[model samples]
Target: MFRTVTRVELSELDMPRADLAEALKCCLKKVRKGHYIIKSNCPNSHVDTIRHLLREPGITFPTFRGDIRDDAEKLRMSIATRRDSLLPEDAFSHMSAALLHGLDPVEVGTERVEVTRPAYSRAYSDLLFYARDLAEDDVDHTLGYPVTTLDRTLADIALDHPLEVSVPLISEGLRERHINRESLLPRLAPGRRGRKRALLALELASELHESGAEAYCAVKFHRHGITGMTPQVTAYSSTGAFIGRNDFRHEKALVVVEVHGVGKYYMHPDGPNAAARQNHQRNMNLVNAGFKVFNLTFGDLFRPKIFEQIKWAITQALEHENH
Candidate 1:
């Protein structure tokens, strides 16, 4: 039993105070007496009343403001149903690193947020990428929220993601053993992946070590010109305890080559002294077994005098063998 008491002025009325009751009445009358058109603009001001009066089943709530919250249901419904516009973060979840580097070849279209959540965490979203049980260091920020780091990303790609995407970044970072090893090594896993990569890196690092001793050792070895004997030699104690794997041991040639790189191991107060004593003990054991051992430093290897010392030692070994 609703009726309009009197027509109210719709002129110069501010939103907060403008005749709410009368406006509601007039809107109702229009719906019943004339073709009711809910104005497309200023939807929120009129939406509540329209919904209350109409109460139509299955009709959607009218669209209003442009914000995601304002039309969240409709937008979500449209996205699920339309199939044209994908969420931004979903479209580009794994490519954030490449995108940050300005290196992504393909174009991504949406602006939705991407998130990486730990498996143990209960938190989730419709568009989030759930990363199962990520390590503490792997958690980092992408578009303000946490994502994986470059190393983690590469490792993920190395293990599970495609090789075409992973190889370029991994090879570039690891080609020079000294360049980014500290940053990259932590991300490698322990089994086959670790051992295989470690061996390759070790070979390069070992070469780099020798290059520091004498630049020509690498060049000579690679050139294959100065070859008397190669580096695989075995050392034995009278009781056979297996002291260490030697770099080079000449059979019946008393010369044992120890190559010194530029940077030594991390030094404490007695670090160098302790290292020297250990080397002396090891050399003593070798010498006691009737072998002459020679150590080479970076400077000594490069020096002509040291080269003569080596050659002289070789000649003596042959002379001793002859005796």
Candidate 2:
């Protein structure tokens, strides 16, 4: 979710660099280089002046605030800009709506904005418009722009994208409590295209998964027939002392699988060295408790060879437990 900064509309003016800077100096506050913020209370005359200046070249007033460096924020700005330029009847849908509703971007690219309008389907420039009738419950204006509700957006994603792309998003929505399966399943009825894939994704969706990567990892485990694993399992010693909460655990096999991101250590609040030390200590504790730890990276999870290694690890751990 985006932090609500000062609500300001951004205008990408077409004028000489120096002239544009001078023109906006009086009515707008220059927030970033080449970007200005038009305050909500700006005089109507100043607004008229901006409108007149852009009579020849059209202007899109995208309302966004914060660091433009963030990719998610950039995508939000893109969605806003596209929405501002579109007809009032059009509403953001599919992946674009999912982003607005705070679902992980996942496999969806930010290059094109997805929209829906009655009796209209076309790809123009950076907008992919769908032709579909939206029910009243499907549309929302909570963000000050027309966007599909969370359930509707998930349904659209399930219909349009594969499980690899859609599962993470659906899982996220469930985890966030933004939408429920009971609400979303009806949208993917019997006659709908991609219903099977959507149903499978919904079946796999779980609120217990912490991140999109973990959710995707669950899908991978399901596909590879890696069974008997539970998510977010807490590990304990034979004496009933807590060791740590694991990403995944198989009790019978006495195995714990941890999915590590590239910046897991570096992005910690404490220094990376401290984070690494803590992780090392945790691993030692888990090992001392007779739990075989299998640490998997994002890259490792994507490659099939790593799963073979994991299978071997699981088998070895199971044999050890039996012995």
Candidate 3:
């Protein structure tokens, strides 16, 4: 926990903006009207500001000290803003380019820092720089200076990463109403390096995928001539009772492609998990009704060989269903 020393005054100057201004300009962040917080790396700055702000009336200047490890969770937003203060320019755009645009935070991820137009410092491991001018609609006061628009963010990620790797973020952004093609397609027209990548990503983009693994497997199935797969499909038993929903299903082939994450997401050995139990019962019912189930994971989708296995499963199921 970060240790803090508090002092209340009567001046009503609140955050003592001028004193903090003279302190570390980087760490001064507005939490709300008449209030501010600090996350300065420079202890002297904090000490000096606290001392100065304490001299004023109606002010509550709290000086925080010690390690911030335990308080990191509560300080997440502060840490993000502090990180933002480190970049050269257009810091927020870098964030949106790689991570924002309503990307699935649980699966794909979010970025800490994005260096803009980073041609010189190409050696840093933790830093990612994008070399491009901000397109129209890329920045806003609410989004902060130099953050990519939803469309531009997807285009940028698509440009930097492989289609399979980047699809989840973009697809989720699309699915979640975070972005669309009208704004994104225009931005793709200007860049040569990412034109093809962005185009392909957009072409393959679907609101159906909840994870990158699902998107990757969907595309591979398409390439493998298993075009009948419908994503996020629901299935029922032969008696017309509700069973469960499948990730990707082909009704004509009587095949269901299951993206395997429920084991980690819902399964619990020590406690009763309704989702897990229901999924198990539903799968058994589907099997009894003659539906062939195909399973894959995030890792399995990475291997090229999984496509052939999927092809075999789909082909065999189609033949059996027709017979």
Q: Which has the greatest TM-score?
A: 2
In candidate 1, residue 216 scores what lDDT?
30
Task: Please write out the lDDT profile of model 1 over residues 1-323, one tens digit for every residue.
Answer: 01111122222223233434544544422322212232222234533433343344433333344432233323223222212223223221233433332222111222222334443223223233534556666655543334466555545444443333344344443433333555655555566344454433323333222222332332223333223433535677778865544555655576666665424433435576676787678778888877667666645534566555666777778888899
Go through the candidates in order and give each one's C-alpha lDDT. Answer: 0.42, 0.72, 0.58
Candidate scoring better on lDDT of 1 and 2: 2
- Full ranking by lDDT: 2, 3, 1
Worst 10 residues of 3 by lDDT: 1-10
Candidate 1 residue runs with Cα over 4 Å from true position: 1-226, 232-234, 265-270
TM-score of 2: 0.73
In the range 1-323, model 2's lDDT, one tens digit per residue, is 22211223323333344544554665454433333444333344435535443333333333443422255545555565454555777789988888777676546744568999997789856668899988888899997789998889888888888776788888888878557899988899999988988998898778887877777787788778787778899988889988888988985787888888646777889978888898888899999987778888776767877667667778888887778
How many clashes in candidate 3? 11
Model 3, C-alpha of 248: deviation from truth (Å): 0.1
TM-score of 3: 0.62
Report the lDDT tens digits of candidate 3 across residue range 1-323. Answer: 12222223213435464665554365454542333454444455444535554444443332443422223223333324333344444444433334433344323333234545434434243344555565445654453345566666666667766665467667777777656777777767764676887787787778887665687776676566667788888888778887777888885788888887645344555444665676677779889877877667656765668777767777887777678
Report backbone clashes per prediction: 3, 0, 11
True-structure Cα RMSD, model 1: 23.8
Q: Select the stronger candidate by TM-score from 2 and 3.
A: 2
